[model samples]
Target: MTRPIRFGHQARPTPDDDLDGVARRAEAAGFDVFLIADHVGHGPAPMVALAAAASVTTTIRLGTYVLNADMRNPVQLAWEATTLDQLSNGRFELGLGAGHTPQEWAATGIEFTSARARKAALAERIEIIGRLLDGDSVSVDGAYHRLVDASVPRSHQSRLPILVGGNGAALLGHAGSHADIIGLQGLGRTLADGHEHSVRWTTDHLDAQLGQVRAGAGERIADIEVNVLVQVVDITADAERSLAQVAEMIDDGTTTTDLARIPYVLIGTVDEIAEKVLHCRDHWGITYFAVRALDDFAPVIDRVRQLE
Candidate 1:
């Protein structure tokens, strides 16, 4: 357990199994956390689904992969996060984001604005949520939302981890300003550089991003956590075959591999995935990784348990 790799599964909107079953199996399979992919127009509510996960798994931390800040109410989110943290024995990590996805906004009839505006709104919302979590009466006025002495002064946990999800230069500021952990997105498998015999710089950019997150983090930066979610498992038998399978998935729209042009979807055997991830820990200085398990990734999950 020297590496302390934590595993989590994507709670698909239309999962094959019941929520309880999915949560139980994930915990039984040695996953340390369970997270849902959050989207408003097309997907289920991440927190609501996580409630079921919390009911079933006692030890595993429960939270969202990344909840869109634009679509969520800070008041409700503050309550939900604290209540779940208590229910799960104080193991909840909140992942918030600046909203994107025009298709989703169109579906919901919500006006989508420039990225800069969204970032500002997200920053304000995080500050509000943090204050409420810390037992303070919050009053604020912003371009998006306003609160006057808004209070949710009760909380079950003293502290809950809030994560900002995105890699845009605009977001690094908020990650530094408010987030306890910053999530780097990993998907769309069109990584043309790493599979070949080139010295990978994916590790290099990750190091730089995490460094920025650390430097930008002012007071809370002291013990900030860095997590990257990578789709690191594929169905094929060998390394060559798995990489090819991942290449095809990139073509088929099942995986995304753009962490500075490195395949975040590390496609290979358990040993291969471990070796690939070690680069993140050793080279990039990123220690916490949340893996998105695919259908063919059962073997990798089994292999991760062996490491444990």
Candidate 2:
């Protein structure tokens, strides 16, 4: 199904950045959504920061780029989600991920389980959280969590969107089955640093990920909105130079051509980048694109919208 093209700005705010002003700026910049990351050492708490953003902005939607499921209990997460939804006047999208950073778990004193275990727990949380957001009394005796007649306050929207993000086959498939949005970053295994990730931006990898999504989505494939987190956005005059730099940084045998073709990296002139956005939507059915910088990406929004 064809969905409206949406541009989200993921704020990587430091202590000096004015939270309220950032939200207002994103809204003024014509972004569809303003999102923050959920990490122990990085930005402020996702829900709290979003609440602050929601208070100052009138139209732009507020969301977590993704909350680490391993760090949160399903019930408490659901409660916070509902509160944010009401406070935002129904403009909340809960983006979740199977936690990947080992340092985050260690810092918080939360056990960092195996990747398989974390994915399993995340699936269970998604089920529980989605049901609770819909105002259903959930009673589940699962491996990760157990709830008896647990329900949260109803959300302001009849159906608050749940966006599940990851690059793994299992996570993508589960998200396809249960989530309203599936966020793809074209990322693979976490590196030794625990913060960085190996790249999975090749055509073969992307096809495999989409195949998994389709496999799990089945008849519901058309109902899901696919989103890609643009890791790099460079509107450069010298495309070859920029592409080579990006490819070297990725260090995954990704060629300049691959970088140019992939939706996760935008490197070209304004018009060229704008065409890539259209190409992504047409070729992959990807209508939602989120980037890290607002000013850098602001120019492409109107261009892509007009092209669409």
Model 2 lDDT per residue over 205-229, tens place: 8888889999989999999999999
How high is each candidate's TM-score? 0.81, 0.98
Candidate 2 Cα errors over 4 Å, as ranges: none
lDDT of 1 at 182: 73
lDDT of 1 by residue, 204-248 (tens): 555566667766776776566667776555544465656555556
Report the Cα RMSD per candidate: 5.6, 1.0
Instruction: Tell me the lDDT of model 1 at 39.
Output: 64
Alpha carbon lDDT at 301, candidate 1: 59
Worst 10 residues of 2 by lDDT: 293-302
Q: Report lDDT (Cα) of residue 11, candidate 1.
A: 65
lDDT of each: 0.68, 0.90
Which pairs of residues collide in model 1?
187-256, 188-255, 188-256, 188-257, 189-255, 189-256, 189-257
